[model samples]
Target: MSSIAFMTQAQEYMFTYSKLFSHLKQNVKQGHEDVKVGLFFLNADTKKNCVIQKAWMEKEQHYEELKTTRYNELLLPLDDNLKSANPLVFVRTPQDQRCDFSMVVMTKQPLKGTVSYTEVEMLLPQMQVMLEDLGGMFASWFTPDVEGVTLEFQGLVDGQVEFSNGKTKPIVNGKAQVALSDIGQGGSMILPQETSRVLPYLPRAD
Candidate 1:
């Protein structure tokens, strides 16, 4: 349901997309019996702030002021795996404030078998686009510390779905992996120092 990623000087606490999607689906189903929500992709950025106030004495009067200008917020997505209809939620920096993708089945009873085939076909290509954008945008985040680190996700189905944008390979075995650093370096990305700890980092999505 939740996990924590401890960095050299940072701490990231967030939720897993799969679990969140399951929860959402359950809620949606309960809210509307027989209604199934197919979630293809989800990216979101949210900012939250905590204010600290202090009192100071000036001359004979007391004054109160907010102490800091920086704000604190949590960034997370509905899914992390780029699988068929599976939620792929992750966190990223606040610099890019955008919600990349999200899809929901508005009707009662979830789409099944051939009913979902067409939609999946349309969704994979678009997801690949997001993948390329994400890889290039956060290329700098990859360090030797993250060398060989990869992400894989797929949908549970009776058959298979393969997708590629020419630059990347097809999704095989119902799974796909995108090397975060490989995008920027043309297969020449430098590696970070290998260490005991695996730095957990994800670009914030909206």
Candidate 2:
């Protein structure tokens, strides 16, 4: 699947998971007054697992050219023979063990009662990129004009990248309000106006 298509799929999964999270908060009522949803991309700026990190970095850089808005290649881990394996998403518990969070994106069913065999998987290349740049996976989706959508991806290619350590570099971060009408815009929904108002010194990607 192309990058655009992958974004759409990921959004759908996010929506599904979000709804499921909401349901869990409501249903498992310890009369639980506090309720929240949405899973964050945890530790997004740093590596979490060494094995996964090595596999991802070793993959050929997606593209050769170095551009500010694009990303390089991504790699996924697999069995010894280079076969694909399902990527696992989990939260770290205080016990130092991986706790299985009930995620709806991976499974179509409720994660409470039965064994959830659903494995949410995506091509590693789809994720290995500077997510907040012009040509990155997040760029187009974040547009203000974009509303509810199910994007169809065309193709995939290796791409360019800009140089700098991730920590100091500033991405075009801005605030956005995702009303019900703006459901399909993925994580970013910052408008040009809001971005301009908040980030006066931001550089133009184009």
Candidate 3:
């Protein structure tokens, strides 16, 4: 089985567990007929309403609810494993996003029922890198043009920052570009007309 992680626009992580049922079937074919699989969501805080919102299998034409434990952990039944290759289980959670939450795949023996913090300590380094990469990808989804306007501010050489439309930009070498925009009105800038610089009079042509 393999896990794929996705980041939603609301900053939530969705995990899709795939090839699990099929893998269990392979184990059955290898003469180990009683192969059992358990999917555990480790490090979830039940007190803070951190629970899985939904779990479903992605089929050809529709979705089927994957049976999970009361706490949303999945314990695959031997009957289901022998029947078909239902290879996908999608799980969505609305809790605060953190990579510390890991989905563990346990097989053969009955699950330990509890995961100690020390057991997952080695996973932090890899999870942290994944988190950082996901964050960068999330940020790259919105560019300056879509989110706001980049306004270039000149004449400030004192290393000051200019603020507009709730955004700020630090002035560097008398120039700074600020991303400014209003939620509904977009963005606008007003420039004073130089009325004192009058144009020279011209004679009418025949």
The top-ranked prediction according to TM-score is: 3
Report the lDDT tens digits of candidate 1 across residue range 1-206. Answer: 23323232222122334444443433232233322232221224321121212211122242222122122112223332422333323333223333222333222222222222233233333333333333456634542222222222223212232223224334343223333433333232111211111112223322
Each candidate's TM vs. the true structure?
0.20, 0.16, 0.34
Candidate 2, residues 1-206, lDDT tens digits: the string is 11111132222111222222323333233322221121212122321211111111122333121111011111122232222222222222222222222211111111111111111011111111111222345655653331111111112112111112211111222222222122221222222121111111112223
Clashing pairs in 2: 62-72, 62-73, 62-158, 63-159
Off by over 4 Å in 3: 10-18, 26-35, 44-50, 75-88, 99-206
State the lDDT of candidate 3 residue by residue for 1-206, as single tens digits. 25556665543444433345444334344322222233545433432123566666655776677676554455554555434654455666655643234433222322122222232232233323322332355633432111222122223343533222443345444333322222123333231211111111112212
Clashes of each: 19, 4, 0
Quote the positional error of residue 159 for candidate 2 in Å. 29
Candidate maximizing lDDT: 3
Q: Residue 1: error of model 2 in Å?
A: 22
lDDT of each: 0.28, 0.20, 0.36
